[model samples]
Target: MSEPGKYVLAKPIGEAEIGRLDLQHRMWLTQHHGLYSAPISKSSKQRVVDIGCGTGIWAIAFATEHPDSHVLGLDITLPQPNSAPANCSFAVADAEGDWSFATEPFDLIYGRMLINSIRNWPRYLKRCLQHLKPGGWLELSDVAHRFFAEDGCSEAESPMLRWWRVVFQESSRNNGIDIDDTYKHAQQMRDAGFADVRERVFKWPVGSARASTQEEKVIGDLQYQNLQVLIGGVTETAVQHGDLPGMTAQQAQILADEAKRDVVENSDRHGYYMHFATYVGQAPR
Candidate 1:
């Protein structure tokens, strides 16, 4: 386990990790429609809060796009650049803590890729709702983390995929976090008293073999790089967590290498992809 006040994930915060996170942000922008899907840009003078903001990329982009809006990017450990857009600010804060920093209600509260870190969905959603202004939006985007195969490719037959599933599931269980919370976003939002909830799902291809168009091919290439970084980041943590039976860090790295090779070389037989969900809801006016 990591030390107190550190991120739960095994990966250390560094330049390489930050670069990977930025790549992920770009991939999400390409996968989803722009930085966010809420009806926030339609109005001016919007105050936005980005919960669990990593590297502050999304917040900076949103602030750049909506100069009239002031964006607050909050994270437990701030790795954001020293210089930011005039309308954007990065703060060190925990999403699960008392949100005393939010002196005023925000027009939008956004979070992405927080499934691995957040422990309580209901409480988090309630807090988001409480911090939101009436008619304001709360948007969340997360990957399911479960791999799937279409076109007769069986991911179950891949040892890498199987190891990933078991180890990650066990890790989440050990940490008391929900690994499949992406599926529960809508229900959680509704239960938190949010209205006009909407959900969008997207499939992210793992390799270029399945891509038919130039854009999809580019996305696949990026996804492959992202997976490589993910393997490096998670292997140590997964082994330390002892989720995989009789697995050492070296053994986990071997399996991760095989899995990455499968994505790159045997994608035709593996055809792996992940499902990402984007959920948006509004505080009742």
Candidate 2:
């Protein structure tokens, strides 16, 4: 478990966070090219569970795609549970806490961006393994949370990078949840008895100013907006959990403002992109 005050919802459970969560769902679709990339069945009897289903967008979409299948979306809290398909339902549950709410095995189990939220991944993967049907499929995703310059423009480093490093990397390190472990997810899944694990990397460009095509521009715009929300949310996290000593709120804000400006200005320059990855694996029959 994280420190008493370490884990915090970046934004409260309200309209603003609801908007961000919904936008985040849409952004991932563009990044991954679909609602799902795993080869899970769309059979009428198929059963799926979306771990950490925020607003139930993914669950609602999946339920629509497989009307005969029952889809359960689980999260600690959902801001506004939209009127979902008859096959879809939402429940308030913590993935890191008791998973007793799950009564039976599932055909496809999906988790995404949870590496940032959950603490004990090995145990979580083990629980996922135990809860899966024989030969069930599992798909997971996470953000690496660092910027990269497309061109050799290392001089374009910004305080945003520092803040990111402090909050996600250093803080996670302090809390024993190294965020950099994102790269080892496939292996971890394998260690947890998952088979045929594969990891696919993706890039999120920060702005559309340097996009070469229309699709790229659209994705860029979405990603830029994501960063804007992220910046607003994570700045406090950095101050609180980042283990940065003697940093005042005023100091942090000044640094964050300059960092946002740098990100905007540098976008027109060499261009920076953030990388994330999705892992697909299966339980052995």
Candidate 3:
């Protein structure tokens, strides 16, 4: 059961999480062309909803950047001692549950890095469709569970892949929400009646030491920083499911550390990266 006024979430929450999410917001901006992937015109007055808007960083930034737009950030819990622009506000909500908090239709609904707790893709997307104005857009972005290496980069895969697999993919399934099924979200969106669905995939490097370009090096370093935070957060969850339950927290963290180390020490050799995909679809006019 979740706390009163809190959405049931798999992620651990705290001050550290807030900082990591803010960092992730910055990292995402460095990786993407803009705050979001969908092509919404700047001049048009818009109503935007950010699902799983951790720390309200993205929503706050989006509202501040596009002052003409009204951006509302939604999550299971809202941050305390938080402040936002006049056009930006936040509320507590679970995307899988009640959306009645959104009194009116939205022009754009965006969800970022929230593939873990969502169980029903098509149903949830259909709900998003129902909440959208005609021709409105839906955008979702997340990193998938594969860590790959290019030719001459490394002969073996990074052990970090194992950490992601067991912690996110395997453990999520044990709780009845399969993170791997995110690959099917685009098709599921189409089945839910979205139109002109498109997906963009980018290879996001794991560590800065091996990147060929300066920009990539910066992003890679950011990625490494985020991974360290994630490992610390997920260690307990990793211990709870799969073959790891009953292990001490320190033991679980040890495994997580090993994986992170492999990424740092072997980034040059492994060319370590995972696929970061952004899915975009529009409600029918």
Candidate 4:
């Protein structure tokens, strides 16, 4: 269980993790070839809301891009720039609670990488539906926790994978949430009375060895750093929740070190990749 006054994510809100999240925002942009997969370009005034908007990077960028749009970013911890764009604003709010701040319906509602944070996804979607205008769009981006290998390198059998499996499973169990809930996003949106639902999936390489193109290498490198930052938090969460039986903090650190070594050395050359999914739905007009 998460301690009081702390968000659902296991990691501490420090410079290192905040920096990782900024890089992750860049990675998502590179992966999608833009700020968002949904069609958000509009010449007229539009109201946009970003739920669980860490760092407010995406909100700022979108506000900068669409000057006519007013973008509101909401999160538990609003670590935003001192001087944001004229059209952008941020607030400290919990996504799980009632969103009474939204006085009017939003034209675009966005969320990213919130799978682990959200407890009741169906209710969340229903709330999103209520806050969206008749023709408004809601988009969510999330990644699967499970690892995959294209080649028969057996890296999936590695201790790193084992650690992630246990940590994510136990974390979800303890929090009463589904860490891999994005797989059901489309159905959930439909159940919430959304229309024109669409889903996109991307493969994110784990290491640079499998990256043939320059873009792939960049994504791979960023992903490698992402994993490096995640291991510690995963282990910490596992220890806090007593997920990994008999695993000490020192032992967890050792495992994290070994996992980093394996990735850096490319010892297995497993061509491992993770699945990133984007789901978009529109409210009935």
Candidate 1, residue 258: how far the Cα is off, in Å:
2.0
Tens-digit lDDT string for candidate 3 (1-285) = 111121111222234423545556655556663566676655548999999887787787778777888999988998543667899988898999988877899999999988775877878999999999999999988777555666444323556666666554555666776656657767888899999787766667777666777657767888877777877676666675444555565766776888778767776666777677778889999
The models' CA-based lDDT, in order, is 0.75, 0.72, 0.73, 0.74
Which window of ten consecutive residues has the lowest lDDT sum in model 3? Answer: 1-10
Name the candidate that leads on lDDT.
1
lDDT of 1: 0.75
Off by over 4 Å in 1: 1-21, 151-156, 212-215
Model 1 agreement with the true structure over 1-285: per-residue lDDT tens digits = 111121111112334333545656666666643566776547768899988887787677678777898999999998557567899998899898889889999999989989987888999899999989999999888888677766555446675576567565666677787777888889889999999788877677777788776656766788878877877677667777676676677777777777777777765566777777778889999
The pairs that clash in candidate 2 are none
lDDT, residue 59, candidate 4: 82
TM-scores for every candidate against the unseen true structure: 0.86, 0.84, 0.82, 0.85
Give me candidate 3's TM-score against the actual structure.
0.82
* Higher-TM-score candidate of 2 and 4: 4
The residue-by-residue lDDT of candidate 2 on 1-285, one tens digit each, is 111121111112233323545555655666655567677754578889999886777787777767798999998886366477889888888888888877999988988778767788888898999889988888887777466777755433656566566544555666667666777778788899999777777666778877776656767888767777777667777676655566777777776776677776766575777777788778999
- Model 1 TM-score, all chains together: 0.86
Name every residue pair that clashes in candidate 1. Answer: none
Model 4 has how many clashing residue pairs? 0
Residue 196, model 4, lDDT: 78
